[model samples]
Target chain A: MLRRIFALMLKEFLALLKDKRSRFVLIIPPLVQLMVFGYAATFDLKHVTYAVFNEDKGSISRDMIAAFHGSPSFQEMPQIERNEQIAVMLDRKTVQMIIHVGPRFTADMLSGRPAPIQIMVDGRNSNTALLIVNYAQDIVNRFNNDWVAGNGGAPPAHIVTRAWFNPNLESRWFFLPGIVGLLTLLVTILVTALSVAREREQGTFDQLLVTPLHPAEILIGKALPGFLIGIGEASLIVMVTVFWFKVPLLGSLLTLYTGVLLFLLSAVGIGLMISSLAVTQQQGMLGAFFFMVPAIILSGFATPIRNMPALVQDLTLLNPMRYFLVVLRGVFLEGTPFHLLIPQFWPLAVIGVVTLAIAGWLFRHRLY
Target chain B: MNNAQMRLLGLIRKEFLQIVRDPSSIAIAFLMPVVLLLLFGYGVSLDSEHVPLGLVVEQPDADTASFTASFGNSRYFSSVPFRNTPEAVDAMMAGRINAVIVLRQDFARRLRQTDGAPIQLVVNGVDANTARIVEGYVTGAWGKWLEHTALQQGQTLNTPVEIVNRVWYNEELESRNFLVPGLIAVIMTLIGALLTAMVMAREWERGTMEALMVTPLAMREVILGKLIPYFILGMGGLALSVAMALWLFHVPLRGSVWLLFATSALFLLTALGMGLLISTVARSQFIAGQLAIITTFLPAFLLSGFIFDINSMPPFVQAITHVIAARYYVAILQTIFLVGNEWSVILPNALALVLLATLFLGLTRLKARKRLE
Candidate 1:
């Protein structure tokens, strides 16, 4: 049985890696994706275009616009005149925000009254709008404090906030760790899900069924190749993340690998189950995607799980990718110890056992 | 009808029958949009609310009580009180709280004597976006407390720059308002590409291409026959997603429905042409599917300005997104759904779609002619 499984693993490797195009598919896309997504997937705002309509030509208003000009986060578009240009600028997608200072701006501040400055934000992309508002708020808050200090006294209270793990709050530190899990999922699911269905479509499954191999042996042979590929893919991504991307690995390599192995088990089990159910390679491809898309979205890789609705949040408890994401981010960012990660590890183990058992049973039943 | 038209009609009917007979194709065509729309609508949200925070007040004086009350009163924070800083830090490490607020021993003394009293905020910066949001909310809460205290003393606090924010297009600033439209682009790309990407490859793998080459059918008739069925299926997918976006998810359709349908048609042709082009090149279903995903779906998802802002990306990556059809479609969808008929935005994107469709279909025609020769 051991020899048979080894032979099957060899065959699977040759099938995936023998052809020049298939070899290229296996090696190059992940690297390209890593570089492409590393730069593209960011929430940090830069070169954000804003048009200023300073109705109050006072130094304070001018100072406010000057502050935006000095900051790297914003770019000032060519100044606009008519009230109509505000709508036109926003509609043209040329500007993300329109800063309009009211007429009573400086007088209200000098007389110690609340002066209103209307900021028309392009809310088409609400995340960018939120960040822009925060930037504007920070600039205004600083100006207010300086003015008050010049007059008589500063504010009596202020919060000195500091981010713990990521000081500058670089988005790269957050997303690169998550990319390790995503790339692993893409490779593992494709490798395992297509194995059995491809054999069936090519009329080789019947010959395999007539062999002396037991169902458990067949399952191991089918799953081991994908398992090794997933581990290799994960290791490559981790190396690139640490050395190339310069994200520090604070945790034990053992802890990270343990989590990855368990994750691969569950991921490979899912692929095998889809393979067992599919009659054709196309069906298997679609089935794999049907499961993979929702898994990634609900996993808190890009969007936070807490932001999901309650029922969907509860539904995420069953998703292996969700637990793996927590493990991946925690192990990379927080240096979380193994004992602290047991809760996540056990659920992944449970999913792996259940899915593998189901796939084994279905393979046996179909063969009989 | 002429014999060529009759042959084309027969081929389209046969493709339709094959699509209906295959459960996976039907599922990909009909069920995928529902799953993706609901998933995107409910699952993906940028609104960060009800963040859990830990509060450590060393001295519980009147000022401390009021200061803590501001965090507790606001809808954004759910503040839990801890006796000391150690306990709060433990909770933060265990992931129970995203941030901790520590009030020092001289809390009230500094408020009365010093010009600026210091309060410390330590945030879990694992998720940087959330941490930034927490900082912003904390500042807002602090400012409100100061304002409330000044009003009580009957002394007007001068805030020189008061911001009155007006969020246009989506006044409430819901993420779904734009996310729902972006979801349409993603769904169309997957369904169109995954569906037709395998058709020509499957024929080759099954040796039916050799059989079909022996017949009198023209290459143009075959390509058109393959595209017409999936085009209808892709259109059906668009209609389903748009209806769900409008009625189920409550996303406003501010532009003309006919125009939305027209742009969707153009985008679908481009997507289908890309898929058919990939199928013609790959010659096997496995490679075709992999190529479709690598070339079509991943680029559409990452580079299309769907979730991430394209302008924020590096310049080289930004240049790459120019060739992606979904970027234009997403721009068109967001404008049509959120902002009403803004031809300045819609016309440029629609023209790009037209150009991409022409390029892709023209490449596919050239490839098909070579295969026939």
Candidate 2:
């Protein structure tokens, strides 16, 4: 029985290799997509243009404006006049933020009175706007502390902070790890979903069934090539994310690979199920798409899982992408030990076992 | 009354019969889009909240405990205790927690003194947006605690600066408002492509096209007949999606209904014609489907400016979007739903859709006449 399954698998694999274009598609597109999506998926805001309206023209205002020019995040644009000009610039999105210094700024400080500076930020892209506000606050706080110390006066507030695990909070540290899961979804689903349908379309599926192969033999034979392809695609993406993108990988390679293997099994199972149901290649493609779009959206890749409603979060328990995302991030960024990752790991294993079983049953019953 | 018209009508009747007989296609056509719209609107959100954080306290004093307790009780964080810095860092690196807060042993002593001491909060900055929001929430909570402590000490504490936040258009920042309107454009493209790709291919596969060609029917009549049923189906999808957006998702329809229909019809014509062009070129259902997915689906999803902002993309990507029919449709749909009947926005997008539809329809007609060598 095992020999028969191996023969069937070899035949399917050879057929796939025979089509030069399909083979090129299977290998080349995954790498290309990995590179494209890795670069495109970044949320880090760079080169944010900011404008200053310094009425004081004092050394204090100049020092503050200089801080904005220093950071890589901000590019100081030409100074603007009239408060209304800020609104116009914001509406046109010429500048992301504006710093306004009041006329009495230096005098208030000399007399021991509070000085107020207003920061107006464009909120069109809320995420970027929020970051600009935080960076401005940090600069202002540092300036205040330095001024107080120079004047031989006490600082206003003492903030003692200790940053845990990832002290630097690099953006690449988080996203590169999640790429492993995203690549698995793209390659496994697209490849396997088309496999059976492609065979049926070419009228070769019936020929395989007529041979001395059990339904299980044929199903495993069909699934292994896609499974291997998924692993290869995952590895390529992982390499690009780590080495090329310069994302840190703190966890053990064994843990990451284990999690990825399980994740691919579940993803390939879903694709095979889609293939079994679809009568035509078009239907198969659409079916894969129908499943894929939701999986990606609800997977917590672009957004946080915690933000989802309780019921929706519960629904994600069944989604393999969610667990893989967790596991990928755990192993790649946090260096989470295998024992610590039980919550993420077990869910993926459960999903893989259940989905594979269901796919096997579907394939067996589908051949009418 | 002409034999050609009769033959074209006969083909359309046959297509409709096949569609009705196959329950799967009918179910997929009507049901799938609704499910997708609902899921996209409600299930997918970019907002971040309730992130897990690891907290390490060196002091274990009341003041430190109280500060840590605030984070524990807050809606945004689930605080887990950590033994030391390395363990906490391990948790963060392993993606166990999004952030970690550690209070130094002298936190209470520093607060008692008049001098301001610096507090450090470490965040995983991998997702820059999430990191920013998480940092803001943590600092805001800490700031509130400081204010209360200062008031208790009876010190005339003053906050020198005030920041006012104002959100426009979508004040609540509900993801549904943005996504539901976008779903209409995506679903319309799918229906148009699927319907047209299968129509000519099915006729060829069933060997009925030879009979139709020999009849007195003009090629124009045959194309029109094939398109009419799909046009109705596409319009039906549009109506259902619009109603779902308004009634189900509460996406306000501020634009003119007539304008929406006109623009959507134009967009559908372009999508259907492109699918027809695919069928004409490939002449096989298998290849037609592949061509349809490659041409329609990816471009509609990526280049149409649905999920990603087009202005932020590279110059070449932005230029490529010019030819994608869904790009114009997405803009038109968003404007109609969010900005209302602003003719300035609507007219240009509508005109673009009309131009694209004409181009694709002309191409399909020209391509249909050429036989395989």
Candidate 3:
């Protein structure tokens, strides 16, 4: 029985690699998606487009405008002559914001009076808009600080900000660890999910049933390949993330790998369940996506799980990916010790056992 | 009717019958949009609320109590007072709290002095997006609290420059408004690609393509027959999505319904053409499905300006988005949904969608012929 299952595993590998497209599917998409997600899946804005309606032509106002000009974050658009242009340009999305330096100019500030500067912003994507406001506010605060110093009236208070995990707060540090779990889940689920459905559709399952092997042996043979591939894919992505992306892997590799191993087991189990449920490969594919989409969304991969509604937040408890994301980010960034990571580890193990048990029952019954 | 028309009609009937038999296509078309829309609309939010913030105050003073009270009253933070900084930092490391604020023993003492007081804030920046938001909210809350405290003390704070920030379009600043509209493009891309590509590739993999090629019917007629039913199914999804966006999610439709449908029809044709091209290249459903996912679905999800900001990406990646059909479609969808008939935004993207549809369909035609060779 052991030799037969081993032979079946070899046959699975041979079948997957024999097709050039499947080979490409197994290798290229993950790498390409890794690169894409690493670069494109960021919320940080490097360049902000804004038009200046600086009615105040004072030396101080120019000095303030000069501050914005010097910063790499701000890219000054073509000058808007009238207030009307702000609307038109904003409507066309030619500029993300319009910095309207009021006509009062530097007159109010030098005389120890409060002056107002209006920043007309496009709030289409509220996060980007808010970030733009924050960046602008930083520049203005510097200007105000200088004014306070020169006037010999020191500012009331200052914030001493320290970021613990990611010093520069680079978004690359945040998303790379996430892609490791997400892509691993995608590949493992697709591989295991497609195999049984494909064999069933091709009427090869009956031939296997007629053999001396039990359904349990066939299941192990089928699941081992997906588990192996998932581990290999995850390790490759992590290596690339650390070496190529220069994202520091602060925690021990042993800790991270332990999570990866347990996570793959759960992913493989879920995939087998989908495989048992699907009648055709297409149905299998759909089932995989059905699990993956919600799994990913609720995982706090891109969006925070805390921000989700109370019920949805509770729903994420059932997802294995959520715990894995925490493990990945915690290990990569926080250098979280193994003991601290236990809360994330056990859920994946539990999910793995539960799903595999159901898959076994489904396979034995050949139930859809 | 002519023989060619009769053949095309017969093929169309077969495609429709196959769709009826296969429930997955229906699920892909209708059920998928509902699931995707609801998930994106409700589950995914960029807004940061209820961020767990830890406060570590060394000595409790009247001023410190008021400051902590202000923080407690703020909607942005759910503050927990830790015994000390070490506990707060430990909680931050454990992922229980994202930020820690420490007030030294002299927090109230130095506030009235010339050099003012200093408070320490340490944030867990592993999730940079949330960190940036948390930092911004913390700053805003601090500023408001200072102003309120100053007013109560009957001391007018020496105000320098006041910023009047005016936000136009999406005044409520809900990420859902934009995220929902952009998601429609992704849903349509999946429907058009998976339904058309997988079905056609199945015909080839099953050796029915060789059989169909031996017939007197032209390949163009067969292609047309394949395209129409899926096109109708895709449009059905489009209609259902827009209706849900309006009634269910309450997303405002600022543009004309006819114009929205018309442009969507153009974008759907582009997506369908890409699907046909993939199927023609990959004669097996397995390869076709994977290829469709690699070329169309993932790129549409990421590079299409759906969720991620296009301008924030590297210059090269931003340029790569120009070729993605969903990029144009997302721009069109967001414009039609939020900005109304902003022709300058709509026209160029629509024109690109038109060109892309022609390119993909023309390539599909070139790659495909009646011959099995």
Q: Pick by lDDT: which candidate is best?
A: 1
Best TM-score among the predictions, by candidate number:
1
lDDT of 3 by residue, A70-187 (tens): 8888788888888788789988889888989988868987776778889877777676777788778878877877876787866466678888778998887998898888888888
Q: Please provide, for model 1 over B151-254, each residue's C-alpha lDDT reduced to its tens digit, 9 standing for 90 to 100.
A: 77898665667888888899888989988898889899898888889998888889888776777788888899999999998898889988999999999989
Give the residue spans of candidate 3 off by over 4 A: B112-114, B145-155
* Every model's DockQ: 0.75, 0.32, 0.68
- Clashing residue pair totals per candidate (backbone < 3 A): 0, 21, 0
Kindly report which residue stretches of model 2 are placed more than 4 angstroms away from their true locations once superposed: A1-3, A14-17, A47-173, A198-207, A339-346, B1-11, B60-74, B78-97, B110-118, B126-128, B145-159, B183-228, B269-332, B342-369
iRMS for all predictions? 1.4, 4.2, 1.9
Q: In what order do the candidates fall by DockQ, top score first?
A: 1, 3, 2
Pull out the clashing pairs in model 3: none
Q: Residue-wise lDDT of candidate 1 within A1-368, one digit each (tens)? A: 79998887888889888878777876799888988888888888788889988788677778777888998888889987778899989988989989988777877777778888888888787777777788788777777777777887677888898898788888778888888888888888868887888888897877877899888888899899889988888999999999998887888898899999999999999999988888888898898888888888888877888878899999999899999988888888889999999999999999998999898888757551
lDDT by residue (B1-373, candidate 2, tens digit) is 9776677778688767877765545654677678878777777666555678878887688787667766755655678889877898878776678777777777777766776545566777655556666776776676567656667779643434334444333446555676677667888887788778867876676577877778666777778887887788778877888888888889877778898898888988988888787787667565565556545554576557666555544455567678888888887787677656757656777898888888888877887762433
Candidate 2 chain A, poorest ten consecutive residues by summed lDDT: A156-165
User: Given candidate 2, what's the lDDT at residue A333?
Assistant: 61
Using TM-score as the yardstick, the better of models 1 and 2 is 1
Q: Between 2 and 3, whose lDDT is larger?
A: 3
Ranking by lDDT: 1, 3, 2
What TM-scores result for chain A when each predicted structure is judged separately against the true chain A?
0.96, 0.91, 0.96
At residue A156, candidate 3 shows an lDDT of 60
